[model samples]
Each structure stands twice: as C-alpha cells, then as structure tokens.
Target: MRKWVFLCLLFLPFLSLAAEREIRIGLIDTFDQDFYLETFVPTIEHIQKTLKDYKITVIELQQHNLLANVVKERPDFLVSSAGNFVTLISKLGAQQIATVSRNHAYSPKEAVSSVFIVRNDRKDLQKITDLKGRVLSATEPHDFDGMLVGMGEIAARGFDPDTFFSKTLFSHYQYPDVATYVKVGAADVGILGTCQYEKLLTTGQIQPGEFRVLEAKNNTEACIRSTERYPDTVFYALDTAPIDEVKAVSLSLLSMPKGEFDFEWVPASGFLKVYDLMKSLKLGPYEHLRETTVKDFILSHQKELLLAALLLCAILVHVVRVNWLVNRRTEELKFALAVQRATERKARENRQKLDLLEKSRVISQMSSIFAHEVKQPITNLIYYASALSLLLQQLGVKDDRVEYALKQMNSQAKRTSDIVEHVRSYAKHKANRSEVFNLVEVIRRAINSINKEEIEGVQTTANLPQEAIAVGDSFEIELAVLNVLKNALKAAKNSLNPQTSVSVTAQKHMWKITITDNGPKISEEIFSALGRPTSTSKKDGLGVGLSIVLSIIENNGGHLTFRRIEPNGIAVDLFVKKKEE
Candidate 1:
C-alpha cells in the first residue's frame, strides 16, 4: 500500500501539466527565438496564474513562413508589426486585439522610428542623397521600420536605394548586424531602429559617436529618428480562435504586471498609416501580383480573342460614322450661335449705356436732396444748443441737471455732424492704401482706441509672437480688430467672471490669430447670422460692425471664422498670409 501511494504522488505533477489547456500564440521572428522566450515567459506565467486551466505556448515564425504557419496550425493569437497585422487580417482573416507598447528610451508606446547611420568620420556622407553609389546594409526587406520605411525616406528624396547604391547587403536575422557592418567599414551606411541603436550603445557594443544619424529630424519627443514614425507591434486573435479564451488572454495581457520585459500590451492603435506605407511600397496587403499579359490572354482564349477583335472593329466603324455626323451638325450650330451672339452683343451694349445714364441721374438727384435735407437739421440743432447754453449762463442757472442737459445736447449735435460726414465719405467709395506692417503694433493701437469704460473689469490676455508682419490696409485691419474686440467685450460682460484672451500662432505660410472669450454661449441662430451685411443680435445694434469687419478681411486676402466653445463661450480665428521676405 505504501509503494502504490508513492507511485501516485510521483505522477501527480505530470498529470496536472498534461490536463492544462494549451493556447498557442504566433510571433514574427523580429528578434531571435531566445529573446522572445526571455521576454514573454513572465507574461505567459502571469496568464497561467490568472486563468489556471490554460497555458500559453509561444511559436516563433519566420517572415516567409508566417502566413503558411498561421494557415496550417491556426494559432489562437499573434504578435507582429501593424503592417503585418493588416496583411494577416486581409489574407488570413486574423483580427487585432491589442498592440505592444515598447517602453524604449526614445520611442513612444504607440509608435517607433528608424534611424539611418554612417561612420562619424565620413564627412562626405552628409545627406540621404550622398548615400548614392555607397554600399548600404539593412535588415530583411520586410522589416517595417528597419528596412522598408528607411527605403521610403530615401525614395522620397528622388533616390532609389536599390539602384542608387553600388551594393546592398541584407542582415536577415538581426538588425544589429547592419550597424556592425557600417561600423567596421564593411558597408558605407546602415539602417536600424532608434531603440536598437541606443541598446547597442548602452551595452558597450558600439561607442558613442561611432556612427552619425543621417538626415536627423527635430522630433518634439527628443527621439533619435530619421524616418517618419510608425505604429508599434500588434497582438491579434485569429478568426478561428475561441472568442471567450481570446478575451480572457487579451485581458490578461493588457493587465499584466510590468517588469524587466520593458513592454506591455495595450489596446490596438490605428494602423492606417502603416497601411499607407504598405500601399506606397507595393508590399504586404498591397503586394503587386502577376498581371495577365496580352500573350497569355491570347494563348488561353483563342476563340474569345477572335470574337473580341471582330466586335472591336465593328465598334470602331460605328464610332467613326457617329463622329462624322456630329461634326456636320456642330458646324451648323456654330454658325447660328455666332450670328445670335453678334445681335445679342449689340443689344446688350445699348441697354447698358441707357441703364448707366439713368443711374447717374438718380444718384445726382438723391445726393442733392440728402445734402439739403441733412444740413437744415444740423444747423437748427447747433443754433438751439448755442442759444440754450447762452440762456443757461445769462440766467445763472444753478441746477446741475440743466447744465448737464445742455452739454449732452451739444455732444449729440456734433455726433450727428460726424455721421453725416462719414456717410458722404462712404458714398464716395474712399480708396484704402495698403502697406506692410507688424500685426502686433496694429492690435495694440486698436486696443488703445477702445473706450476704457467699455472694457472695464474684463481680464484680457494677448499672446503675440515678436514679429507677425503682413501686407494690408493697417487702418482697415485695426477697425476689424476693434469690432472683434468690442463683440468679445460684450460677451465677457454677460458672464459671471469676464475673461478674454488672444493667441497668435505663426504657421508655415500664414499667421493665425485666435480670440477666445468665456461667456454665455451664443445661440446657433445668432451665430449663423454673423458675417452677413446688416446682421446683429444686440437690441440697439446698428448691425454693420461685423459686416464692415468681414469686408475688410476679405478685401485684404484674409479669412475669419467663428466657433462655439464647449461649456459656454466663443472663439474667433483670423487668418492672414504672412508678408514674404
């Protein structure tokens, strides 16, 4: 009895492992099999612990054998680049579940970048164009960032690396090999990922400044990059995989504890950018297949070819006859059109002259009437205000209210005269003189022109670059700025705490000035009416301020747009072309 019990105990451990459910995962041979094993063992162990019944088995697949293995074995899941994921989804119906977020020194979790390097001592190799006729070393052709993206960068600069280089060598298994080749003078240039280069430096395999990063980019993330960034590796589930098991494994991977692996699985990031790269290179999902040629078509379908040729000849004859008939009809129509056009032109000229004379006569009469009618009202108001002021002085009127009323009367009379003068100037179509000037100076002058009382208690801020020079009528631009400022002030006054800010950004070809206000939201109806002539939402508004502003902006080759801000407010963007140096 004791011997039998010992035998049962000895076999129990093997029994447990044999009963454990197996979940196979396919991984691209980006790194060697040992590296993947070392990196993913912790993740697999974690998944097994979380779901005790299931154990993960990682299967390394070469690029050439990747699709074949997936089709033959049908692994439950996969780990590969975004480009490969797109290809698999299209070719094998695989679905992406998660993306690997590599925690490298210079790479972001969602994307990676490639760097082109040459020996630092090689001053002749200054740019991508300089790589022409030089020996180039790269990883496998299908390597996304390491090989393909670098080729795209060179191709964009009008150099085909394959033909341009005197010799091209590929390191099939490891990217580091390319760097080593370039370092030892075996190759003039090499391509590798930024992370891999940094790793080589940290490990003392490559010295600092041993290789120069060619065509270095000024990336905001401080990453050493040469080519445009692309999305990181993807973790996907096959269509044949069990949904429940896939979900369990996906959740486990996403929530897995972070340790020495330096990477974690996050939800899938978009792969359209990768898809675009694939299409541009004619690889992966966009791979160019063998197209049928004329010879092949004829050999395969002799009877169909004969029938097609006869039908084509018949169609050509029909087309030629139709074209000849069309030409004959077209000539007849042209003659009729010419005669009709001549008659219409004579009639239109006579009508236009008559209309112009009538308009001139009407305008002269209206101008005379307006001048006569408006002069009498102004003269009477001025006379009455002067008399009232004299009477108040002579009578020794001690009442402050009486004196104030006289003062207001005089002010109104002067305002009436200014309006009349302004109308006359507008009717005369006054020309605007344009000159190049700094926009910041114009904004300051406009702000100073506003009544201090109108902007009282409003917190205002301006963000302007040192120089935003533009060519336009300074007076007109200032007037537009004043009108926008006035509207923003009114909006600010309506809110609990009034705050307005102006931000200026200089773009490649234009300057963008944005004014934001914190106030009650403008209704859609009122917003839609803005920018139209004689449109306003204010109760006592003349509805001409924004109209004039719009006209001024449009006449000066600028654009203005209004947007409603969330939680209450408005933003106005003013775009103007920068002055050419």
Candidate 2:
C-alpha cells in the first residue's frame, strides 16, 4: 500500500499536465531539439503565461515524417523555415500567421543567405569557375541557405554546380561539418549558412584568415554573404487547428518581449523567393515535378527542328520579297494612270479650242455669202423702182407697163427679205421647236418653198398619205425636206426627159419618205462627203445646204440616206419616228 501511494503521487504532475487543455506546436528538427528549446522556450512560456487556460507543448519532427506527423498529430501551430513552410502550406493546408524576424548580421530584414568559402592558402580556387571538377561540401541537399541558395548563386553566374563540381558532400544537420571538410582538404570549396559562418567566427572555431568568402556582396548590414537572401522562418497554423487558439497564440507571439531567442514576430513576408529557389533546383516540395532537359530534347529532334527553322526562314524571305514587288508594281501603275489622265485632259482642252475656231470660221463665211446673195436682189429692186417712176411721170399712172414695173419692184423687195431670213436662220444655232403635226402637210409646205423656175423642166409627182402624224421639230423637218427636194430637182433637170417623184410610207413606229430623180449616179467619193460642210458638186454652190439639212435631221433623231436608183437615177430616203409608238 505504501509503494502504490508513492507511485501514484509521483504520476500526479504528469497526469495533471495531460488533463489540461494544451496547444501543440510542431517544428522541424533542423538542428536539434535542444537548439529549438533554447531558441523558442521563452516565447512558449510567455504565451502560456498570457493564456492561463491553455498550456504549450513543442513537438520536434524529422524531415521524412513531417507531413505524416502533421496529418496525424494535427498540431495547433507549426514553426518552420520559409522554404519548408512553403511545401507544408501547399500540401497540408497550413496557414502562415507570422514570420520570424531576426536581427541578422548579414541582412537588416528578416532574411538568411549562403556563403561559399575556400581555404585562404588555396590559390587555385579563387573564383566560382575554379570549382570545376572540384569537391564541394554543404549542409544538406535541401538546406535553403546552405545548399540551394549557394547553387542558385552559381547558376546565376551561368554555371551549373551539379555538373561543374566533381563531387558534392552533404553534411546533413551539421553545417560546421562543411567548414571542417574544407579545412581538412576534403572539399575544394564549402557552402555554409551565413548564420553558421558568423557563429563559427564568433566562437573562434575558425579564424578570420583561414577561409575567405567567395563573391561577397557588400550590404549596409555588413554580412559576409555570397547568395541572395530569403526570409528566415515562419509560424503557421494547420487547417484543423482551433481558430480561437490560433488567434490567441499569434497575438501572444506578436506581443512577446525580446527574450534570449533574439526573434521578433512580425507580419508574414512574401515567401516567393524561397519558392523560386526550390523550383529552380527542383528540391523540397518541388522534387516530384518533372522538368525537360533542353540539351537532350534538342539533340533528339535536331533534324526536324532544323528543317522547320529553315522552312520558316524561307517563308519569311519570300513574304518580304513579294511585298516589295507588289509595292513596286503598284507605284508603277499609279504613275502610268496619272500620265493617262493628264493626256486625256489635254486632248479635251484641244478639242474645245478646235470647235470654237470652227464655229468662228463658219460664221464669217455665212456672213459673206449672205451679203452677196442680198446685194443682187437689192440692186434689181432699185432698178425696177426707177423704171416705174419714169413710166409714172411719162404716162400719168395710166399705163399697164408702169403697173407691171411696180409689181416687179415689190417682188424683188420680197426676194431680198427671204434671202436675209434664210441667212439669219443658219447663223443662229438654235434648238429645234418640236410638235406633233402631219407629215404630208410638212412635205407640201417644203415643195411650195422651191421656186417654180428651178423645177420648171422637171416633172414632179407626189404620192402621200392623207393623215400621217409624227412627233418632231416640224419646222426643222420641213427645211430638211426642202433641201432634199431642191437636190432632186437639180438632178432631174440635168437628165434627159427629167422626172422626179415623192413617195411616203408608214411602218412600225416610223415614217419613210423617198424622193427619186432620173439623174446621173453619184460617185462614191462624192457620196461619202455629200453631207459634209464645204463639200458640193455644183460650181456656184455654197456647199452648206446638205450639211445643215443633215444636222437638222440628226438633231430630230431621224436618218437621211441616198442611194443610186436602178441604172440611172438617185433615191433619197428620210426616216422619222411616229409620235405614238
């Protein structure tokens, strides 16, 4: 009974601790439990003191069992480096609450870096390139600052450390082992965490002159580092953690006093730099991701890729050449078109000038002809009037001869007026006054205009329709008929036993008039030029009558044609449209 009571009393404290509500935090055993205990125990004690209802427990986890431990234990919170937290946060639903900020010797921000070191007496390992075929040592393959950052720095300098160095020595947890390896000549170069390098210096384990940092970057914090910096550590909560407890622990950590741990909790910084390093080296959480080796892929498809490249180059060259040719041809065509337009414009201007000159010449010639034609009639009128005055004085206005002379004077005066009117009508280039009228009446009117003396020797016969109506300029058509009749009369007078006939016929939508004369057949050359101005067969002809008649017929949309009659006569056909279709 006494031994049982003693064992029960001894187990009381442990049982009480287990019974209390506790918040568990998981940490990776990066160094050792003692190191973490020394580093974080005070912060845990501070949190426990603040939260009286909850106790704090720290669980150290190995790397290989970290994901399993987190899933099985489901700790309330976790403590890890930024690189490890990145992997856990992605895979295990961990949320970062705060990042551990330290007053690092090499960085003013909460960051860590890697330093590459070589023995001072080794002159051959002066630069990173000198490490080719040399032995390299580091803490661990996945150590963010010790190995990954160091290799990333070498890669940034265009060197692949994996193939550049002959061998790589992994020291696992002891970063100091990397330094020792270099000092013992096991490695030509060493990569170590900047923190560890500084710690070794402070403890006098390695003198300042024994090893030198390679590619040391100068910073205001005066840290001896060769690689870019990354965030130091992070505190996060798992997805299954109690929300209230996570908040309380985060608040306590943020407000904790600066203790022996020398760490301050601040808002979490971006961990993308660590993520980028992992992705570059394919380490840690990124180890399972596959990557293509560019050298191998290029070598395997060299012929196909080369052919594709050559075809692409050829196509590009052809496109460029075709574009140049098209532009050149377009410019040439534009120039030719411009020249053609200019030439056409010049020809139009020349034609207008020629038309104006022709009009002026026609006006001058018609004026001269008009004056000559009227002069003879005026002189005859004056002579007859003088003769009438003498007879009236001698016979006291009673003689028939005096009356006859007065009539002759009146006739001569009328002839002069008609000549002047005819010349005036030709001078004015007026549009025809059109109306509906009978075609037979128009022909009779045209025949009445001809002088009886001119056709006295020719026998004239008219074959007409009683009611042939047409739509046109009646006066213009009358003049055209008169011109045709006068030509036929002249031709008939020249023939033996001269005879002339006028015939009219109506057909679909048109009136056809034929005037025939037993006259000489016209020569083809003269017939071709029959309607041209200044072309005539008669010696004293003004040569404009047929042309004027042709113009009148054309303006009324009618046609005039002359053909030789059978054996020895001429036939003139005039066609005009009926008013009603």
Task: Report clashes for each candidate as comma-separated counts.
Answer: 0, 1
TM-score, structure 1 vs. true: 0.46
In model 1, the runs with Cα more than 4 Å from the true position are: 1-20, 32-38, 105-110, 158-164, 173-176, 220-222, 289-581
The TM-scores of all predictions, comma-separated, are: 0.46, 0.45
> For residues 1-581, what per-residue lDDT tens digits would candidate 1 score against the true structure?
99999999999998876654678888777753434665556666777789877767778777886778777766888877777888888887878776666655343333777888999989999988888888988877777768877876776676654577798788875554888889778999988864667777889989997889988888665367888887777778888888878889888888876677767767755577777777666678777632348788789999988999999999999999999999999999999999999999999978866865565455545655686579679978989988988887898877788778878888768756755554454446555566898998888887887898988989999887787898887766777787898889889999989998877898776777888888897777788767754345679875656755776677777888888886689888877668987
Report the C-alpha lDDT of model 2 over 225-253, residue by residue, as the tens digit: 87888877678898878788888888988
**Ten consecutive residues with minimal summed lDDT in candidate 1?**
101-110
Cα RMSD for candidates in order: 19.7, 39.8
Cα error of candidate 1 at position 286, Å: 1.1
Candidate 2, TM-score vs. the true structure?
0.45
